[model samples]
Target: MTSPRKVRRVVSLVPSLTEAVAVGAPGLLVGATDWCVHPAGLDVVRIGGTKNPDVAAIAALRPDLVIANEEENRAPDLAALRAAGLDVMVTEVRSLDQAFAELERVLLAGCGLTAPPRWLDDARAAWAAPPSAPYPPRTAVVPVWRRPWMVLGSDTFAGDLLARLGVRNVYADHPERYPRVPVAELRASGADLVVLPDEPYRFTADDGPEAFPGLPAALVDGRFLTWYGPSLAGAPAALRAALRRAGPVPSPRRP
Candidate 1:
């Protein structure tokens, strides 16, 4: 009888999972995708991007386990890895609650941690729902991309995070998880605020705010709004601060 192989060396395809495992187990993560930027100064062999990882390179690393997300990773890649005889752990987190449960599973069951990581407990406490002080009501147009104009539509981790921050996504029932809506339609969607995050599309104060003429734009951190790792501990407070900065700036008085 052979015992199961331990997760000694891990490769994380999801940026959030990378940070979780890297911080929790330290040195267990040997490889990660190029996009795994958290815990800055993370020293590991860069395999490639999430959607298109270097399979050959990853196979060469001989990882005991590879962490990925249902959204960030592609099915074909997971299949190829499995075909190569490597164990792949995929996570799916559409809401705040699911994120917590999945994080615990990834850290303990997937990575073989003896107990729940401290960050998980701290994150749970940080986002313990029902609010300490009720924030003002807000209806927001949360755009994650531009040029093509994509928004946070139904059942997304970002949308759930925003909901907890006292902001309701205008397109929460758009049918598509991330629907491509026309800019003009978005402007007329009766959203009082535009919540833009600096990732998947870097929306700066100048770059994104101008699109919504009169709407207050809350430029929040994408990591805080999207990633479900150690950053979850600081996300609520950071997002609250960003939302407070929401206000429309008049366009330079038209020279």
Candidate 2:
């Protein structure tokens, strides 16, 4: 049974959410998943990975709340947590707007914070206006994985972020959120660039860029591209730096 009093303890299963709570209320989290890598020196009990958390260990922590993401966590796992009498807060963030709203919901309501965090405000401000330097509109193919080769499709937070950066995803109209496409199809997508992030599959400068030799591959921080947390504050500048380094951005400013 969940306590009606103040939430004194928390266990986060989502990496982004763990960072958000860890930053908002230090020491509030007694337990977090192995993937919760933000707030650098976070010292907490490691439950397990996002997809495969140790439910027994998490319950043993006796947390006031357990945070999870709809996309990153499985339904049965969430169900198991709830069945174990844990107060689970599952979040869904498919766009930048949703991120801010969900963050507020999770931090203020779920964790019982008095108000919103400064980083949330800073993140909002960072994306308040599109950058002054606008490149000619470009299209991109964002591969989250290789081998089987899954890419971001429609209604995704990262795709929305890229769109805000003025880069349209070629697969934005696909029916599935994350779809698998053949390497040949991805190569022939005619996108101006390939935006690759360094998580889910760890695409690096050497590893990912070689896949799309014909297109300029921008190896980006997956945390910035995907995670909606403290990293969001500097994502615009960080991503801009990476994207600018990619061939298509500019040799000289339009000014």
Candidate 3:
């Protein structure tokens, strides 16, 4: 393992990891994927998208360490970077607790920092317990994409995030992590609410709500629901507010 001083130049392939390292130690990041949009006005070389990063470009930067995530990046891409002799650190964040632990590893252990940033502490405190809601847990379907209609299934970080906010994903028991079910099936799943996010598919009031005529749909910030980084600090409040506005659902409209 290289010393802290030796790990100065870093490249981040994952958006959340990029934001974590950038917020923790901005000067350390030399190159990052185009999708690393957090910490707005970040002035790093664009390496490409998370799925298709410019390996040669990243190699050209000669970074001391390249950060990645198991789900956000492709295995072959990480392998290719390693094949070129670049040190790549991959993180796995399946749950909120895992996210906190991995953030510490990346920023402190990987970035060679003595301690985690204050936002990490703030994030931990923000989601320490489930939010106090007046109504009972609402069954919801969180769609990440529209084409072929993929929804959040069992064991997803987003599912756990919503669960913490008192919203239960109807498909949380599905065998697949992200299952592609037809729109008809999703509408008939008995979900009282549909939580739409503005990412991975960019669902909006005009775009996604019409699918379920009478079901209450909550349009939320995808960053808070999906991204696990400094944003986690405000996620609890933001998500609670969105769910609050969803109010109650009406009877399902007959075809």
Candidate 4:
């Protein structure tokens, strides 16, 4: 385990982890995936997408550590990096608590930091309490993709985030983490709202809301909904505002 002091160079495959690492220690990152777009003017060697990183290019960088996610990066890619003698720190974040803990582990334990970053504390403070509601929590279907129609299902970080925000993911109890369901099934899933994010699919107000004719659709920032980094600090407020502005759902049409 290379200590944080010894970790002068890093290659990050995960976008969220990229932002987290870059924000925590600027200039420590020498390589990152093309999707690792945060901290705005980040200048690093692009290693391709999360699923298809150039292992040879990464190995050539001779990074002290490569940060990845269990769900984001393929095992074979991580193995190839390890085979090239690169140390890989893989993180698993399924829920809010796990996200915080895993982040601390990556920064403090993996990066060997003296203390957790201030943004981590800010994220914690931002989501300290569940949203106060006047009515029962709204039931929603959170779609990550459209063509195949996969949705956020069971024990996911995004689902947990929505739960904390007083929105219940209708498919949270489904067997799969991201289940592919037909558009008609999703529309008839008895959801009170359709939470559409702008990435992984880029669902806009005009693009996504039409599918669920009578249901309110909240077009949210994908970074807030999916990315678990410095953005976590503002995610709660941002998501809540989007939900509040969702407007009313029209009455369901009779068959």
Candidate 5:
């Protein structure tokens, strides 16, 4: 009988996946970026940032498998790695559902076996039914990056996640992907919540309530709220927790 091939020694180029594997399946993570948190003090070698990994440094790790995300990585780097004869698998997650599936796929492929995190079911349930009574639908704005000010457009994971939360998207009106808008426009939104993600851009209360004063501001964890993967299972609940912290959506109540 032929022996089974060993699939050990992994290099994770995706920030969310790197954190997931480090928590879901540790020890095997031979390389990750400085942004890869979770698992506390993971000594895995540093490659580079999520968008642009130091391919040479990663190659030195001699990883049998390299896990990266299509959304987080660039084409040129991937092409370069392919030309170098390195085995790299990329996962592109446009929605929350896709994120969960991809995380499971990566874990199974890299670790041979893995258990779905407990948060998965909880997130699903939370999304299906929030704690609030009659969970009134709300319009909201999800900003991923600033300066130019990128927002979560229709059909994206951020949009879907908000939909799951029983909130209607304000930018659903726009057709462009991650379109930029003026702050003055944001101040005039019909949205009840101005979701300020911790990443892509870090917005603080000091930034001024006038920026989003009329609407209640929600400070959410960008990783959980945006990154879909094994991490997704926990996100809905994290969102719920954030919502709870922010309290029930008030004002502009429907008649």
Candidate 6:
């Protein structure tokens, strides 16, 4: 049998969770993403990105622990970090339920123990029953990029996220991991919201407007909505906030 783990100070390799832990679990993070702009005053050392992290820079931080995701960081990169004598914890989250479990695990590692707050279970339960009245399910096509256009299809974390938020996925019919298709397919999908993500490929409203003329399109913070890491604890609440901000869709009323 293997021995237990220990953690003192940590560096989060995942950008979305960097802010969540910065706000949710403070003073424990010593390293974060260059894109991690939360907390306003806390200065965290940058350790490159989820894809191409600077191992030398990370070694300089001298952290006792590191957090990474299976889908976010490639296998070779994770192997390199492990070879460097850094205790790395890797998580694979394919659904919102798995996302919640990841956040709890992070909390356990950060605190050097494995006890979870009771409220977490309650929080997950709250989502099962929508507050007030249930709104009409909105069909959304979340595009991560253009040019060899990619979209979140069935069995993906992004697709599961939409299901949790009461939004139906327009690309549930597609079977590919990240399919490349034409704009003509999008026009035929009849999606209510053409959500443009900010990462992998930044989609600005100006770029997608003409492509999705009559559709309700918006540039959304992809990390918060999609990344399943320690930040997942805040995602349900964040989704609710986004739903309120977007308000109700006038056109394409519920069928």
My TM-score estimates for the predictions, one after another, are 0.93, 0.94, 0.95, 0.94, 0.86, 0.80
Top candidate, metric lDDT? 3
Local accuracy of candidate 3 as per-residue lDDT tens digits, 1-255:
555545889999988888888898879999998999988999999989999999999999999999999999999999999999999999998899999999999988888898789999999999996577535789999999997899999989999988887888999999999999999999999999999999989999899999988788899999999999999999998988888888865655689
Tell me the deviation in Å of residue 155 in model 4.
1.5
Count: clashes, candidate 1: 0
State the C-alpha lDDT per candidate.
0.89, 0.89, 0.90, 0.89, 0.73, 0.70
Sliding window of 10 residues with minimal summed lDDT for model 3: 129-138
lDDT (Cα, tens digit) per residue for candidate 1, span 46-69: 999999999989999999999999
Q: Predicted candidate 1: what Cα RMSD to the true structure?
A: 3.8
Better of 1 and 4 by TM-score: 4
After superposition, which runs of candidate 2 have C-alpha atoms over 4 Å from their true positions?
A: 1-5, 249-255
- In angstroms, the error of model 1 at 29 is 0.5
lDDT of 2 at 57: 95
- Candidate 3: where is the Cα deviation over 4 Å? 1-5, 249-255
**How far in Å is the alpha carbon of 242 misplaced in model 4?**
0.6
The true-versus-predicted C-alpha distance at residue 22 of model 6, in Å, is 2.7
